[model samples]
Target: MNSCPFQRARSPEQKAERRAQILEAAALFFAEQRFAAISLAAIARQSGVTKAALYRYFPSKEALFLALYLSELDAMVEAPLPQEGPAWAAISELLIARPLFCRLTSILHTVLEHNLDESQAREFKQALLACFAQLAARLQRDFALEGDQAIRFLMQVQQSVIGCWAVSQPAPVVASVIKAPPLDVFQVEFGDALRTQLRALQAAL
Candidate 1:
């Protein structure tokens, strides 16, 4: 018997649940559409929450998407980096298997992070640094590298993924043009480029 215009005020647990529900809906949208093209209103519509209620949890669409990105980053930190087989293939396989995560990586720094406020940005970056530390530790365990060296390698691989995703993901016309055998030299498959870069890094190390 509680009634409010936007929605009844939520308990802390309910708030967290609502936040997660919004994130799940937003993830599906991001998977289907480009990150820059999606709006907060669309996300709220998909999540079945009013815009005001959604704002209560996320503050902004960028913040919400950043949360999704960070969640995926945490999962990556937990998952072991490729130990056996071609390192490039392993890296590409891992990224391709989680296409949404891979897609968001290309926009996280430039678009999503750029729109956030200082406080929110700091909070997210702090969590990211922790994830990076976890990744470095994991890499050191599996590869013959020092802590700093492991972090350097991981950072390079991260940069390669972002760059490759950007160059390889194109519009329909561009993609069609790139498919021609003569233009193959200009064509770029993100996973393949990522894999090649990763393999080179592995070879060096």
Candidate 2:
């Protein structure tokens, strides 16, 4: 017989707690494994819910990941950046410290958004645009970037993070090869590379 560790959550509070549990489990799984390597079944097991029950909160693995990604982004947006540093530097530091956020960001458009239905996809875009607007406001106020320029700077930052993250985390075979002398030149330090890109983008702005 199958064990039922997570019952059907009934109350609104219970549902909220169950959702948090699922997201926490998903976040931990993402931290230790590549996104492609994880499954809804695995996340359900980790969260102590059946795969069927998991759907009560998240429609799909992509949805689950998207939710976690959005939560991470929301937290980042809510936190204030350091006052002493350049905005780009502070932004780079914030992103680099959150490995799961960086990893998810790298695969966002490629993987996370791939399986979403139209409504889910639209919601995700809306949320992201809101975040960008908030960030653009920060750039205008703190960094003296004008309206469109602030938006452009934010776009450049996202591009740099995605590009740098991809280069920094290659396939296992490529990673091993990069450990050797000449190939070592190809290795990317995420923070340094991202910061450099951000600095260059700011200079151009």
Best by lDDT: 2
**Candidate 2: C-alpha RMSD after superposition:** 2.5
Query: Model 1: how far is 163 from its true place, Å?
Result: 1.2
- What is the overall TM-score of model 1 with all chains considered together? 0.87
TM-score of each: 0.87, 0.92
Residue 191 displacement in candidate 2 (angstroms) = 0.7
Candidate 2 local accuracy as lDDT?
Answer: 0.86
* Candidate 2: residue pairs that collide: none
Query: What C-alpha lDDT, on a 0 to 100 scale, does residue 118 get in candidate 1?
Result: 83
Q: Which candidate is the best by TM-score?
A: 2
- Candidate 2, which ten residues in sequence have the lowest lDDT sum? 1-10
1-205 per-residue lDDT for model 1 (tens digits): 1123345346888777677778888988887887778888878877778888788878888888889998888777666567786544555677777777878888877888887778998999898888888877766666556887777877787888888888888788988888878886778877678888888887776
Off by more than 4 A, model 2? 1-4
Give the lDDT of residue 99 in candidate 2. 80
Q: Any runs in candidate 1 off by more than 4 Å, and if so which?
A: 1-9, 80-90
